[model samples]
Structure formats: C-alpha cells, structure tokens
Target: MTTWNLNGMKHHLFFCNGGSCTKKGAEEVVEAMRDEIKLQEADVRIHTTRTRCQGRCEDACVITVYPEGVWYKEVTPEIGRRIVREHLVGGSPVEEHISYTYEDELAARPDTKEGQSKTKRKEAQTK
Candidate 1:
C-alpha cells in the first residue's frame, strides 16, 4: 500500500465526535477550525478526523494533535480556535489544555526558530 504524505506539515488536529462529543459541540469545533484555517490562510494542514470513543467519556469531547500527540478533551469551539491559533499556528504545544499523549515523534516546522536551529544543528553534525 502506498502511504499518503501529509507533506511534512507541523500539526494534525483530530476531533473525535463519537456520540458523546457530538452532544458537546464537536461539530461546531470542526466548523470553527475549518473557518479559522480559511480565514488565516494558515500553512498548517489541519486534518480533522472522527473517531469512536476517545476513551475520555467524562471529558466527552476530544481533539488530538500529532506529531506532538497532545490530546485535548472537552473541547469547545472557543478551545478549537485557541488550538488553531496558539498551538497549530504558534508551533507550540498548549500545556494547560493537553489531554492524551502519543508516542509518535512529531516533526518540527521549519518556519519556527527552534525547529530551524534543530535542523541546522543536525545538518552541521552530519557533515
């Protein structure tokens, strides 16, 4: 099978509606993210996917960011906007709102200074 490339983008935000989350405005969050992405013309590819039972029923609504692998439960439209603006757009993980964790190594965006420095350091050492 051929793997689909996400084009080496920074973050991937997944919103899980999965019954419980739908009642908590998960759809609204998705729409908001779509609108925000268009409004800002952001370079980051905000992949929105629906999953079953994010396993945080108490938290209900959930959104997971990859390669950072940070999960945000009980997400709202406001929170969604913040995620896009702060974490997705800013290139930093939002600690206060983080939920679950992912083991996948998230690639850093070359646009950010820290990411740039890391890349430079890696390249220099390789030579």
Candidate 2:
C-alpha cells in the first residue's frame, strides 16, 4: 500500500527539465526559480525539485506545484520568478499562467518533501 501522509509540508514545486522542456526555456525557469527562492528566504515552508519528464510536453516548460498540483505551462524566466515570489513564497497560486491541474492530490496525499525516494528515507533512518 502506498499511503501518502497528508499533513506534512505546505508546498512542493517540481520543475520539469526534460529535453523538450529544456529547449522550451525550462533551464531559464530553473535559474529564475533558484534566484527568486534565494531572494525571498521565507518561513512559509516550501520544497523545490527538478523533475525529469512531467508528461506534459505541449506545456514543455512546465512546473507542477504539489499539494495543490497546480501545473503552470509555457513558463518563461520571468514567470518562474514571479511564481516563486507570489505563490511558493507568498502562499498564492499564480493563476495567470496555470495550464493543467489535479487538486485532488492536495487533499489526499502529502508530497514526500522532494529530493529523495522512500527507499532513501529508509536508508537514512537505518544509518
């Protein structure tokens, strides 16, 4: 049973860096997000991840915000920065750039806090 605990962190931001997305400005989005996160240094709590393929190639330059599962597409460097500041940091999902979404995850499962798999977590615990 893959039970995802639902009462953990606040937000999880996953940016897709697959080849298609990269050609579509995913790299710039990544850089912008990094810079913006450094600038805010907030206490609201958020996790940022660089994912492989999110399977939304039409929206190649895509970022998926977890808990919310709010997918923003056609992201430019500028939009990425704004999303960090406004949504990830300020607790508001930027609506203007939203493409696809599945909010059910937000209510049902808590994200794994990024950067690790369940096996990795178990290994760390064992060590």
Candidate 3:
C-alpha cells in the first residue's frame, strides 16, 4: 500500500461506495471527482477515501468533504466535477448539493431529502 503524504491536504473527501450508492453510480462519481481534482489542479490540497455506508443510504452517492464537514447528496458525475472546481478549487461549497454541513454541530440543511426515517436514529440515540 502506498503511504500518502497528507501534510498539505486541506480537504478530505469521503466517497461512499456502499451498496445503495453503488446502485446509484457512486463509482462513476468517484472517478469524475478524482479526474476533476487533477484537471482543476486541486489534487495537492485534497485527499479522497472510499468508505462503506455513511448511514445515509436514502441519499445514495454521498460525498462528504471534511475540515468544513459538508455532506453532499445525490452526486452525479457532473456534480462531482463541480465539487472539485467550485468547492475544492474555488474554496466554496456547492449549495445546491449540500445535504448536511457542520458548523458547531451537524446541521441538516433545508434541502436535505426527507426519506430517512427519524425512528431509526431516535432509537439509536435513545439506546
């Protein structure tokens, strides 16, 4: 395995490759994002990792960028590229695709999709 030099990485992207996201074309999004990062010349400051389910299966193809802690949902290939250009390169979050963002805490944006069952987390929280 190659050990990465991540000293200059400002953003860590967690690309979900879980079952639901795989069905939703997550691999393509990952590739598109990586390609765009290179094309936009933002690779030095950004690092990416593929992860299992992030518990937002309803919002398949989730891409979470850290430090800023922004979670983007329904990321198509085009949106993946836009994330690299606008957010990674331009230092701005893509507002339209954001499902959740962390301020002092994790805040679900108004545009967050409503399919996730509240009962699930409520049970986990109560446990």
Candidate 4:
C-alpha cells in the first residue's frame, strides 16, 4: 500500500461503502466522484477515502467532506459529480443533498433523515 502525503490539500472526502450504502449504489457514486475529480483536475487539491458504516444507514450512500465537516446523503452518481464540481471546486456546498455539517458541533441539515436517535434512552442519559 502506498502512504499518501496530504500536503496542500483543501478537502478530504470519506465515501461510505458499508452494506447499506453499497446496496444503495455507493460504488457508482464513488466512481462518478473520482472521475469528476480527475476530469476537473483536482487530484492534488482533494483526497478521497472509502469508509465503512458511518452509522447513517437510514441515509444510505452517505458522504462526508472534511476540513468543512459537511455530510451529504442519498447521493446518486450525478450528485456525486456535482459535489466534486460545485463544492470541492467552486467553494460552495450543494445545499439540497446535505445531511449534516459542523459548526462548533455536528449539526444536522434541516429535513434530513435522522442519523441518530431523536431521543436518548433514559438509562444511557444517566450515564
């Protein structure tokens, strides 16, 4: 395996390839994203990783972009390409597909499916 030197990179994207995400067509999304990156000549400005379950199966095909902590869900190949074209390159996030983002803490994007339980269990809360 080749170790990467992430120097001068602007963003790191984690593409979920867990069972649920795969079932939802993550492979196509991944390929589309990669191809778009190459087509747009952003290989050095961004890095991508294939990850296991991000615990957001309800939002299958989830993708997380770091340095900004923005998460996008239910991504199709077209949206995957757009994420590379718009967000990674154009300096603006794609609003409609966003699932979560970080602003001091992880904040869910409005109207997105819950990635965690809406209510904490009483016993768990006690801990």
**Candidate RMSDs in order:** 9.4, 13.9, 7.2, 7.1
Clashes of each: 1, 0, 0, 0
Candidate with the larger TM-score of 1 and 4: 4
CA-RMSD of model 4: 7.1
In model 3, the clashing pairs are: none
**lDDT of candidates 1 onward, in order:** 0.68, 0.73, 0.84, 0.85
lDDT of 3 by residue, 1-127 (tens): 1327888888989999999999999999999999998888778888899999998898888999998988899999999999999898898888888888775345467655543333455666789
Candidate 4 Cα errors over 4 Å, as ranges: 1-3, 112-127
* lDDT tens per residue, model 2, 50-71: 8899887877799988877788
Candidate 2 wrong stretches, greater than 4 Å: 1-9, 104-127
Name the TM-score of candidate 2: 0.69
Clashing pairs in 1: 71-99
* Tens-place lDDT digits, model 4, residues 25-69: 999999999999989989889899999999989888899999899
Best-performing candidate as measured by lDDT: 4
Clashes of 2: 0
Structural similarity to truth (TM-score) of each candidate: 0.68, 0.69, 0.83, 0.83
Show where candidate 1 strays beyond 4 Å. 1-5, 102-127
